[model samples]
Target chain A: MAVYHPDGPLILRLRAGDVDALGELYKRYKTSIYRTALAITRDQGAAEDILQESFLRLFTHAHRIRPDVPLHPWLYRVAVNLSYKWLRKQQKQQKATSDGVLEGLAASFHFLPEQWIERREAQEAIREAITQLPLGHRVVVVLFYLEELSLKEIAEILRIPEGTVKSRLHYARRFLRDTLEGRVPVGEIVYEFT
Target chain B: MSSRDLSSFDPLDRMVKEALQARFAGAEPSPRVWRRIRREAVRQGGRHRSRGIGDWAWFLLMARPTAPLVGRDEFPLGRFGLGMFLFPDAATLMTLRFGW
Candidate 1:
């Protein structure tokens, strides 16, 4: 009897130039990948672009990928790297924009609501808090809570030490807690998606 | 608050998880993304074929022969009883004869 290996058949078919296998892999992981990109970049268009680029990289580099390993972390690594690249580009462009200057000034001020309200409102508040995190912390939080990847997996994806991942997670959680408890008021959360 | 203070609030983790779930619960990539993926796959397939050995083989087969090795005055010996003719090279003639 042939033993079953998860992701093995799809990867094998992908290596053999089967487009259907690529589509299957995409269908399985696109949501997670898209969410990760969306969480990190906070831009729908950028997330979509990262989603496509990640899979295209997989298609082009399928031969080089080890069939013995799970493909998820590798895909995450590609998405994260692309997200960082996009962030860096935005940072550079923001330096030249007057609106970016005004946004920077607004970020320095803390704006807080008088009292917390409904569950839906609280959820939106938490989402805003996440978006307020710096890119490094935001990514770790997204990977940990949103994607539910282990510290080791996230470390491998980010090419960081496990200890570093732990530290980043700790910092991210603290930042979110502060925001949630009204100790910190991060102004005007930008909702990229309607 | 410090990291330890945050760690003590375990419920925050649950809250964050719930918020993330709620925020992206119904999120789906646009159909255009799949269309783009299919298009890119087709383009990559074309690139793979162009870089393949078969493409090189086809190119070599269709290549116009350099100035014929046999000139008007030269009667090259035909080993297989085939009539002497303007042949490019032994390899080309052999390839044609044996369908190599």
Candidate 2:
């Protein structure tokens, strides 16, 4: 409602005081943020939580927002960090379950659901192959392929080097190919589970 | 055949791309993220202003048009954004690279 350049400048001006801009921005990206969060965290509830927390962090750090600089990457970085924490927590919980218990628990969590049959088995196999990747590779693959973040953006989101992301993606691809083609056993894949 | 070309032509690489594309065959843009972000943006303003006068900077950032917009748009902006953020001009890197 305030008078200023109707282009991007006005958006920035309103952002200085107006709450409408916040609503407008949310209207734009809620799905990608939550979907990306869900793809990594693998929990719908956690994904929604991360979506809220990540945006909340963005609001808290708003002064750090550069009028001309990008926003999604920063928010992504926050969301990815939060998801990584959840992943780490899951790993710790799994580790605390003793040795063979993890495999059993994983079987329960990762196996075919009630509705799944032979056809679904094949689909599950594909996803399982992906889930079987080393944490690094899994993150890269999911973020790039499932969430559709580009290599460079993935780098920003993950706070890693472009070369590192590319290499991880490279290895993730080779590993997934082997897994899906049944050339490698799911348990044999060396995952950077940390 | 040259090694670079051979590596580039790797079936594994091709398969990965194929698999990913196949998985997300009907990938949609992230318009939904914008809606959620707007809600947090205002909630953020309230918290930041309540922090203290010294926290005015934090308040302004929540108010920035570019912040959440950046979050929703960054990945969607494609390879061009990738180059800018990941492989910025050396000068750009030099300036922003103090510490996280």
Candidate 3:
């Protein structure tokens, strides 16, 4: 039974006992998946764990599932669960860093003091608005804008109806627009992917 | 602006997308991912079962055996000890005197 991989042709090789296919899948989605994980976890280490665990699951199941089917949603499902587990584990392991202990003292330090006032203010304003969104709305926004999943696919990934995804997006857009008006600098909004 | 107004372009949408793209650029895989995943995969135990109904990893890893076999080396001849795993010497092969 030959099953072609969903996103890239490399996955097919994985089923044929080829390790190179696994490496290709890793490099292709690592950036976007890591970004999505980072957005949810808000910590680089936690996000890295999510990214790695998701791919590991992919490797383990490389021969079982239909390779032609999209793998990102399955990857997303694994990442989301792992992230929640990590968060729960954090509750049991509590040892605040020195940065947390002397945060008040460190607050007075002028780190990166040379940023243009308007540019820095605009960035802060955008971040504050995103942080203010309801968790569900924020996630939908991240999936749509960052991971670039379609609304239909987002609903499938979140296990909700498409209408609900659309509604949340509508509400999120309005909130962000109101919060960020007159703040974002005027020009083309460009993204230089690293 | 309505969806109609958004037909041409939308700054809010653009800004939101740009903001997310900028943040996503810094993501990467964790070092401890493999150990955790392999543990979970073993626990799952869903796929595989071809060679001998149980873990056939050794068989899969083993080299393929050459074909054709029929000799006094081994066979089910009436009971146990039909033939021992003994290599024939140069004189034994030239004369079949032991079989009778």
Candidate 4:
């Protein structure tokens, strides 16, 4: 019995100059890529852009990619790099804005309903906490938890050693645990992997 | 939060993962994103072809012989005279000078 490889045919078709193969690949992985980008960037527009850019990269580089290797890590690597670029750009813009002015603007921007405030606050807290993480730790956490990539795969995507990925993930979890100590209940938290 | 409190808590990885999943669940890229990608791909393809032509032109220019078509005497071997002291044999000197 021949095992079917979904990515194999699509990648081959893409290398053969079939644009529809690109679209097919997009349909298969867009949600996961977009969510990963959104998890890293915390911005809808930037996530959307990263998703498109990731697919575009796959399209352009299809000919050079080895068919024997899995394509998922390569795609995620591109998305992660683009997300970091977007985050760096956002940081630069934030730095350019005066702190006091930004604080005042943030204070005035609250318009959520009373009923939604708690939910929104919890969500915002998680997002803000993730954003506060150093980019290295943040990317590992996102890949491990959000994208459910194994340490080896994350290491491959990030082009780092597996030991580095493990340490980053360990530190990231510890940081988040400390940061959300009071907000998230101890019993509710679950460790997916040791 | 105290270190004891942090130590007592369950692993936060799952919670963070759940929060991310809940927040981004059902998220999809807008149609405009696909359109933009397609447009950019077309533009890049055109640019790649033009760049490829330019690369070939550059390669040909670099590959063209630098030596003049005139006699070997026209080109001074003095620039390579130091090589003669290291390799006194005529055949070896000729090979070094002509890069045969």
Candidate 5:
């Protein structure tokens, strides 16, 4: 008996140039991809563009895509590559405007005023720390935490050794721990990986 | 259990996850994204189809050998072939196709 795989049929349909299949895939993964881009770039407009370009590449390269495997990793690989490209160009052009955008992103969460006040400070500090990370470390942080992808999966997506992913994550977490320690009360910062 | 298992109930990981989730909770791309994607896809599809037709048209036009042809060296483009004529420079082609 053939095993059931959700993406197999969608990928086959996509290969046949069915835009609706692309749309279906987009509907399924848009939020995660968008959040990944948003977290990495810290720019809403650039994130949207990355999201659109990622799907468009999926559509255009459907013929080259293998239908046997899950499509999630490929989408992530493309999104991360595009985000890196944007970040490189952006670094050459302007400084990050994450303060206002991060504030807006946090504000969009409909929390009660008191809870918002309490959580907002910590969340903002955490987010700022994340944004301050080097892009390599930031990509790992986003993929690991935001997308909740496993280390093996992240290594595959980033096309890096698992040890490299672990190291980057280690570096990023330490940076965040140090940055957040004095700014916000994050309790105890443990180096579990050690 | 593997030494690489990251599921050891780490508080820092949990806090990072919560902070990320809270920051981007309910965040999504606007509807315009799909619209623009569709438009660009259609445009690219049309461009590919037209380029295919152009290639065939160039072939058919050349197959007859009705027109007098110049030497490959006399016409620098002749070395590159008529395909180069059908498609202009990359910059112009990109501008024409994508308006960028």
Candidate 6:
């Protein structure tokens, strides 16, 4: 039985040289791709660059893409590859930029100043712990938790075996738990996601 | 952290999810990204189209018969006319010479 893929038609249109179809597809997945890049790279400029490059590749390689399959996974794969390249190039400089961004984000007060400060502090710690993780483990953590992708989806996106993904996630979770155990009061840290 | 343990990490999973969401709640790419993509895509499409047209134009020029640059009576290099025999047309001769 054939599954109905919404992006199939968009892919066809794009392959037929319809720029409007590309725009529609971009609008559909831009946020997901952008967020994925941002989470992995931890740099807004690099993330934006990855997002643009990913879609441009899609446009260039439209004819080679299978229209029968969903497109987001391909976009995720491209974004991840681009993020890996960026990480390789900016390895030494990443920590300083990410920490500054985290500090800036923690300083902004959203609601009650007291509660916001404490929660932001905890979040900052968690994020710092995430950034400390090895690159492969960090990618898994971001795709699993931030992107909310399943193990299978992550495996396909990363082009690694499911066992590797599971191992990376396990180690990442343990590291985060160990790093934030005594420092953050996990029970008191309450955050609402909009 | 055992490699075989693949079950959900429970409260830790909850914390990680919430923390990530809270941290990047309003994060978004700037509108300029799409603009730049569209511009580059259009430019690339134009390049491909022009290249295709140029290739077709070259094919037609090479394929179409042309009047000889000089009549057989005026043909020079009598025995060494291999270049003229092979090219036969002024367009092909000029193309080979100037690499247009």
The number of residue pairs in model 1 that clash at the backbone is 0
lDDT of 5 by residue, B1-100 (tens): 1223455466567778778888785689999998898788777751223333433655643553323676444554453355445555543577679875
- How does the DockQ of candidate 4 come out? 0.17
Please, what are the lDDT tens digits per residue for candidate 3 over residues A47-90? 87778778766776776656668777877767766766775566
What is candidate 6's DockQ?
0.17
**Chain B only, TM-score of each candidate:** 0.35, 0.31, 0.33, 0.32, 0.36, 0.34
Tell me how far the alpha carbon of residue A1 in candidate 2 is from the true structure, in angstroms, after superposition: 21
Candidate 1 regions with alpha-carbon error over 4 angstroms: A1-4, A99-109, A183-194, B1-9, B46-100
In model 3 chain B, which range of ten residues has the least summed lDDT? B78-87
For model 4, which pairs clash?
none
Q: Score candidate 6 by TM-score against the native.
A: 0.68
**Compared with the true structure, what per-residue lDDT tens digits does model 1 show for residues A128-191?**
7777677888888888877777777888999998888888876776677675765323333222
Off by over 4 Å in 2: A1-17, A105-119, A183-194, B1-100
Write one digit per residue (lDDT tens) for candidate 4, span A1-194: 23256688778767776566677788888988998899888799899989988988898899877666667888999999999999988878878885464345434333333443365565665666777789988988777766777788888999998888877776777767676656654244354333
Clashing pairs in 5: none
The number of the candidate with the highest DockQ is 5
For all candidates, the clash counts are 0, 30, 1, 0, 0, 0
Q: A96-140 in candidate 6: lDDT tens per residue?
A: 567464345434422223442376676876787787788999888
- Higher-TM-score candidate among 4 and 6? 6
Q: What is the lDDT of residue B5 in candidate 1?
A: 28
Per-residue lDDT tens digits for candidate 5, residues A76-164, read: 99999999999888766553544354355434432424443366666876787788788889898888887878888998999999889
Better of 1 and 2 by DockQ: 1
Per-residue alpha-carbon lDDT of candidate 4 for residues B31-76, written as tens digits (9 for 90 to 100) = 8997887777767651222222323444543343356653467444
Model 2 C-alpha lDDT per residue in residues B1-91, reported as the tens digit of each score: 1112223345444344344445444443354544565555655553122222333543543443555456655545543444344334432
Docking quality level of the chain pair in candidate 2 = incorrect
